[model samples]
Target chain A: MDLVFAYLDPGSGSIIIQAVIAGIVALPILFRNRISAVVRTLRGGRAATPPPPSAPPTDDRPR
Target chain B: MSAPRPGQGLVREPGSWRDPAGFVYRRDGAIHRQIAPVFAAEWEAYLASGLHDRLVTRGAVLPFEDAPIADALDPATAWRVIRPEMLPVISWPWEWCPGQLRDAALLTLDLALEALDAGFTLRDATPYNVQLRGTRPVHLDALSFERRAPDAPWGPYRQFCRTFLAPLALMTERDPRLGLLLRSFLEGIPLDLAVRLLPRRTLLRLGLATHLHLHARAIGRNADGKGAEARAVRLSETRLRALLGNLRGTVAGLRWEPEGTEWADYADRTSYSDAATAAKERIVRGMAEAVAPTVAWDLGANTGRYSAIVAETGAHVVAWDIDPGAVERHHRALMASGRERITPLLLDLTDPSPALGWGLTERASFLERANAELILALALVHHLAIGRGVPVEMIATFLAGLAPNLVIEWLPHEDPMVRRLLAGRHDMAGGIRGNVAGWPLFREEAFRGIFADAGWEIVERAPIEGSGRVLYRMRRSGRA
Candidate 1:
């Protein structure tokens, strides 16, 4: 098993780990906000109005 | 040089035992460092503070990345990952010409000074850590430094002196070529041995007095079971800074001008007509277009005149020559031209890099690591053939193993240069011979017969206009 792991490209391995960590960290925050909105609506609370979508096009330049 | 069996978990390198911290082989073609669990936090702190980055940026140390601790079977143990930009060759200190060795020594001291300022000290000081990357010194041991111990004296101080200071002092004061001591002693020269070899007058030099003389005395006192009282000499940070300054001053003062090697005189003596030289350059460029090698090695590259032609075609080239003066001038030319791809190294092909360190497994041998697609061995066979008395078949056999495609120049005895080589030697000759006896020299039949015996298929041959020299492009065939 150690020998098999050693043969894998280090750059490829680092990229895979980075992706996995990003997904794991993002999932919890996404689920919590969705749950809070649903609960507030069930309690007959007024929904928070959405913000205006009049913002300029977002900058997409790479760092 | 033996290959390990398929399932071996971690093939502990034979050379690893010399290092205090264990080094292990990973299957990915990279070496990993495994520090003791006690040093784990210190290693992390050292990396987090940008010390590694600073050293690497300065070319003082090899760079590494933090590896997951869980990678190890024992979660308690921690490790670091280093993917070293592979060197074209691992030159032993013994093989280094005087100037090359001096450069390595000065670079080591420069790294030590920078490392100390980064709040860490080197654990081991060995010349093996310094490797030449394009005529520039780059440290190879990524895990050599650790967080300084507040209570312990600087651990590697004496070692630094032995590995760099003593060798440099001997080369400067006595004979420049004394750096060859590295070959006889795998580790740096022993301090006691260095003390003996140095002249009595060296004892009068202030820097040598304190470092080599007193330092060796301190080690001797400790060995004699002298009380801890004698070992209690401590230095303030200010004094330590002064010591480092003194070392830097000493290194800067010692210099050697590479001179007096046969090939160093080659540029002035070369017999090529201007048109012939230009034609040779065109042939090299055309060959480079066909092969398109990412990396090429030019063997016997006398001052790298033809190597530059291949370099112009956008290939990284390692121009190797046996002559120190020639290599020095070649390196200077490449530097002045702002050419980053050409690396000139001093090497004698008669005896190449051997497997070194314990059980001969620590460093890769010469042929074990070779560069890419094509190799140019132009105008060099005569030296190996007539000068060294090596058979043509033997020479072909060696070149075949090094690269897939070879551009070889066959200089017939009728060539002026070939006549110059034979001017002094006994004329017992018939021709360049194979294992079998009695052959005619430089005949086309003899050349073909030798290449065939060595399992190389001649692909192309072109004769030079003004000389009997013919260039042959040969492809290696599958036969051992």
Candidate 2:
């Protein structure tokens, strides 16, 4: 007999689904500081001036 | 492992069977976890990770020992069996006060950060995975850790938000009574629900905005097609750490000072004279020392005064009270003192925690876990008898089922506290006096007769001077 195991039930699966989408939108913002640095270097300028450390990503952009 | 003896069956703890990685079972009063073959890779990697050692060292996780038990219920499925050190008392999230829940949430985040540092991630973040080792929250699931993938988001993010962040946020911003919401949503408080309940000002807080409000909106918008499409998304380890740090900061910052409850100031308003209070304390202390139980349950343990007394004798005491304010105060004291033997929890003795979740066995009820060798009912019987209108016989029967020996107090109807509880209440008898109608036959002799009939032998009884309260040390019949 073949046995199948499900690690994620519906509740967990749904959460993972939502978290995945949020991750897509949030990850770039999370690494915006780093991304800006790389972008500046590609344009031959120092990475976009790193945001003040006190400032968290305050962007309310829709995902 | 060896074959089981004929007719010797293993008892799988009902609440623990849900997690597929393993199931907790008991044999001859010993608690064991059976790691399944499906979880072998993760289990082996976790054992080698030193993360377990780190957590066990700091008492963050309950330590277990690899043991070769005689048999497994299903040998084909069992990869390894380990015997975990049993916690004296197991409690749930609903029973936790605001402070306890916050501490637990912070513990989960701390462990998550540490696990990420160790190249592993927690698979889930259910509050149920955490249990109190005294006042400290200890993670109980060994298989919850999995090898971390580079640039992968934390798998338990939603769970953490629902179980820890949302509840803490509610208790901090709203009323602590919102903590009871966990009793219904066994999985967790839906992020959407939390967002709706929280005030608009909370949106200004980054942690609340990112983890709860925005997350709820994201979940709602992506309800059908979005999650599957976004599975390919990845988060760098640095980003994951930052997320966890934000959660930890939020949890650490949230605080609620327990106040304005009728029972929070109980000890201050007590009618006992100084001499009588000392005598009562001496009696409780003497009885506790006499029994010397390894585990003690103090029912209605307001602020845990007697519980502290029991703990001083090297016994683990689960101090339970219905009043959230009192439980919160007791928990704060326990945390401040770093008391490692007393656990304070919120429990309504009249309506205890019931069987909940799938098949109604996911979480054990109060009575299922209330058993202890020594039980203290100080100043509690009257509350159950008069405050709740439970008959003395029913209360005795329930208390008898909890422990073999009991230290109980009987407050006469004339006692000030009892009178206050009975005041202005309609009497059931419909006599000219309105107060007597609802009052049951709570006479001292009747109470003793009920306990005696319930199979308890009174070991010692005393009336404190200056008060009409009688304390009895009753031993269950048939127990030495």
Looking at model 2, what is the TM-score of chain A?
Answer: 0.33
Give one digit per residue, the lDDT tens place, for model 2 in B1-480.
778583266788887766678888887768888888888888888989899999999988889998764455556688898988988888999999998898888888888878887898888787898998888799998778888867766667878888888988898799888988999888789989999999999989877777788788777876676555556656666556666776777788889887898689998888778898988988888899989999999998999889999999889999989888999899888888887889999988877999888788878888878758999998887777656768778888888889888999988667787667666446633552355433444567877888888889999998877787889999989532
Model 1 lDDT tens row, B123-152: 666677787776666788766666654532
RMSD vs true structure, all candidates: 16.3, 5.5
Angstrom error of the Cα, residue A4, model 2: value is 9.1
Which residue pairs collide, candidate 2? A37-A47, B427-B437, B427-B438, B428-B437, B428-B438, B429-B437
lDDT of the candidates, in the order given:
0.65, 0.79
Worst 10 residues of 2 chain B by lDDT: B432-441
Off by over 4 Å in 2: A1-6, A9-63, B1-9, B424-442, B478-480
Best by DockQ: 2
